[model samples]
Target chain A: MTAHPDMHETESSVREFSVSPERLRLTPEAIERRIGYGDESAPDNVRAAIEEMLAVFDSADPFRCGFRILDPGQVAFHPDRIVCGKVIFRTGSIIGRGLKGCSALALLAASAGPDLSERGRVLISEGRELAGYVLDTIASECVEQCLEHLESELAAATASWGWRLSNRYSPGYCGWDVVEQAKFFSLLHENFCGITVRSSGLMVPLKSASALVGLGENAERKDYECSLCDREDCIIRNDG
Target chain B: MKETSSILQSIAQCIERGKVNRASPYPPDLRDRDGADELVRRAIDLGIDPQEILTDGLMTGMKVVGEEFRAKRIFVPEVLMAAKAMTAGMEHLRPFFASSQATHRGVMILGTVLGDLHDIGKRLVGMMVEGAGWEVIDLGTDVAPEDFVAAVERRPESVVGLSALLTTTMMNMKETVARLKEAHPETKIIIGGAPVTVAFAHEIGADAYAPDPPGAVDFLNSTVAEI
Candidate 1:
């Protein structure tokens, strides 16, 4: 391939994350904005703060992963190779269940690429290219950490029946709704997404996504291939 | 060519000075002044050419900030302030832009890459490109290689700009560039943001690595000249 003319830039990752939390003194001013901590003065907020940042930290960590591709017809999508879609479910509360499902869907979309067999499985892109280097690492890690958090939370929430989650998929960018995103978001965890919906249902921090994850029996798994899906606007859906 | 004494010179000064309109309060002492918007309109009404206004006035102000930004003399906040000033000036000239009397610096496609959502750098490039007289098509944050490629298919001759704030994502710049080349070989690519450097720009085969928006302007000016 002919090389682009300006490909001469050297990549430099940021130097801030090197310091251990113990070596550094925690200033309220410093950590507050870092984690998007709302009302530092609120009681029980530090736990919330920890929950928020630690969840991001967990998501950014390299996630233990597993994948398999079923026949294209076995999934819910057409042959659009770029769609990242899934269904999610949990044993108990609706919100926690949806949150777990949605996060997995986001991971499937944002990180999963394509399996080598072409049968269809979660695939990671060559690398996450969200923005700049530091920003991408930060966002990618946040997503990974979110899945870990959701998994643990779902474990806690389950009392009777075990829950199962399919893949995660967002709207508008795909064949999903540019409108009705609010209802989709109602099923997510915002602080972890680093964005919140306002009274009008607009997501703050601007950059965010929502998706549907179906919950069902293990035999009922419809491990959908993005290629089989038809959402063209997907930022993650790409085989071309 | 007309001498620099054309009405375009005054219009350029208005933009550089952030004078939006006569009644605007910004630039405190210039209060009750007719800023770039009015100045540009008057110049147009008086038969000063639109292209002249763009090249001479608007481009001049943006070029100044681009230089300041590159030198680190002005940071993000200040450049943003200048951009605000430029916006006030450009509002009245947008129609001329659309009509083609005032041609853009060039068409440039800009965005943050996939798995990345940070938009400050891409957004900055967009402002600077717009300020520099180019019509920008922003794909917003988390742009996929396919998106960039598809957009190039739509506007074949335009320059493509890719931004990444993370080291990890910067690597993906290679793939996006690859897709562009495979599909659009003649297209030029520009890379930038905190994590990028000139050497890396070359490594990815992008045409330019602008440390700041002014460098991008300089690249486009030269590129246009080459064309």
Candidate 2:
């Protein structure tokens, strides 16, 4: 994708976006789907639990999202590696194939902050496992919704410049090694969006997500093809 | 005096229906009815056999839950509720087991392997195993292999359950299992997670692999039967 002449930028740019809990809504159906409740509605007690958690969420502000956009000239895609700016990401073949033909990469991170995660942990420790589990599910859903909102906004902005945004692929999912999360994080400012990767490669706050999206004329935003990936335990595949 | 059989049956019913206490408003169908909490306390006051309460009441109800979960007739929420009700009943029985007046079916040590901070699945297994009348010592998440070795050393007879959510962390799970086995070859280790499979379990030399909490419970129960 060629950058608009008027939009010429010589270096990577970082953008921070804050999303309110209300702005990122989750439906009962979405919860049911995430819990793998296929072809059946959640039980009444489960619905009651969800309603209670939603009430808590309604008053909570836990989402913070930010991304560093690498200029096309500084991005390179190999058969199994992604070079963004000065960093090399061994993202494996699946991500390589996904990002192929793209001119730019957006390394984005979204988190459900720390409060909600702490609350969920406290609930579980207090023997309220169902409520804690429900809260965790809601947080995951919210983070994804935040990412979707960011993606939609970027698509609109890039579409005006005749560029397409590909589907975002995370480090831990598909064939991408999660250890590359360190390299991915290196491209962003310290604690961007208040997210941090542990030595084990687990993102702190636990309810956070990081991914890379390709932007180019050939970049396609297609439905996630679970079949193309070998990770049968992926939440998206299980949720779908 | 209430017929003991009827009370035990009621306790099982309360557990299966997820009626925790009289005040619990869950499972609307059982609202305002005596639940597992009251039923279990009443059973204990009446001098019902604690083992019988565990085997015939809590375990029986949880057995149905396990089968339902396996068949996909119920999901995690239902299982969670059932486990909660079972917990309420188990509280009344805890004193007996603690005093050796009653016995657990077995013991199991559970944790999310090192590098994996995910604990929801591990906690679910702990609840299920405890509900099925086994003593569960949950080591929590991000547990190193040495921790597993130490825990197993303390409770050599206990079955060990290792969990991991990420593929990268699953490697840590393999390492944890290997270390535990090398230290205590007699220890039976069961592994589970999203990425875990029967083949992977075999490859890792684990005694078993369960895809869900109920599967873990069933596997533990089968091991007890084997013993």
Candidate 3:
């Protein structure tokens, strides 16, 4: 139920946290892996594209993240809906089971800046498909790094309470309905990290991701629960 | 003729290395050298057939890219760069191709189904197919069943490809395949993306499913050969 001291005071009901780009340090190897290269050396052209994309990301400080912490006691779980404080989440058994033993929950949203997505659009328009693809992939990595940063911050904040952290669970993964993203967003301030949910439940910027992390003594700390799902093409599942 | 053949071979090499033109700085070894664009143009100026430039130069290079991609020796960024280089060479030959002075292997209509704005996979498939000497009519993202049906009607001989990145949006692909099949049962339909699998393709009654762009190209080639 406690908010981080670094949260920016807003006029709206939502609490906002300020996350810097310094925290989201993406590595070349990680970027390569995300683009499906794995441990193998990327081709020269692919490596060059990654370098160019890293330069673009370096010149701009466009990463941002916002989150809110909720007490587990305030969350109510049902068959098809989860009520967290004032917000109601229309989730399923997957999310329900995932968050079972949490003393606290962190609702987070992060983006790799709007300009990154804009640059992708411009590159696509100019027929720079390679550049666009690299940018998009890098943006995804950047957002993931932002989540990593957020998880570290949460770990630090909760260590005093002897709480362990569960890996982040995102809507649209592990059978959680993507439509629940609207409810997750409702708890955050408007324009949180400059990411907007589309009518189709897809996040705008196309590179933004929202996730929930459980914090408690009993929370299981492990890699993503990909084995529980049937998505055959999941990169995380395949990598594991 | 020997010089012209050499130029075509150079163009193919440029594409494999992802050198777009003299102005492009990629593949640092090829920096400041005439790339696919110039080499392709020079081949045409030397009276090399436009179709020869396409088949012997662009398609040959893309075939290597496809093989390497399938083998996991290269990834998306590499394939995309090669596609860009192939596109640079193809631009010069478009006029000849449109005038029927050059021939394409077949036509393909590609798109991401409705409610899905993700098109990177679809675009990659389109580029690879185009580089493989197929005429690709990209319908872009959020394409409805009607748009696909309309495009199929316009190019009755064309194959159709549907891509979707989200599990939620993947249902739209099934609906699109069903509609396309009901309307033009003879048209070949291929589906792919992050969430699509061969099993899903079969369940949806799609003609084929490719896990990646190169696989899509291979499917298109095999299907067209059957016809």
lDDT of 1: 0.53
lDDT by residue (tens digit), candidate 2, A42-87: 8888988899998888887758997766767778889898876577
Quote the chain B TM-score of every prediction: 0.89, 0.96, 0.96
Total clashes for model 2: 0
DockQ of 1: 0.03
Candidate 2: tens digits of C-alpha lDDT, residues B1-227: 35889999999888787889999987888889899999999999999999999999898898888788778788788888888899899888888988998899899999999888898788778877887889999999889999999998899999999998877788887888889989999998999998778888999899999988888987898898898
What is the alpha-carbon lDDT for the whole of candidate 3? 0.81
lDDT of 1 at B102: 73
lDDT string, candidate 3, B86-162, tens digits: 98898899899779999999999999999888877788788889989999999999999999999999999999999
Candidate 1 Cα misplacement greater than 4 A, ranges: A1-240, B1-7
Give the per-residue Cα lDDT of candidate 3 at A195. 82
TM-score leader: 2
TM-score of chain A of each: 0.36, 0.91, 0.85
Q: State residue A199's C-alpha deviation in candidate 3, in Å.
A: 4.4
Over the stretch B127-226, how does candidate 1's per-residue lDDT look in tens digits? 7888888889999877899999999999988999888765556777889998999999999999886657888889989988987677777787788899
Return the DockQ of model 2.
0.62
Q: Rank the candidates by DockQ, best first.
A: 2, 3, 1
* Candidate 2 chain B worst ten-residue window by lDDT: B66-75
Error of 2 at B207 (Å): 2.2
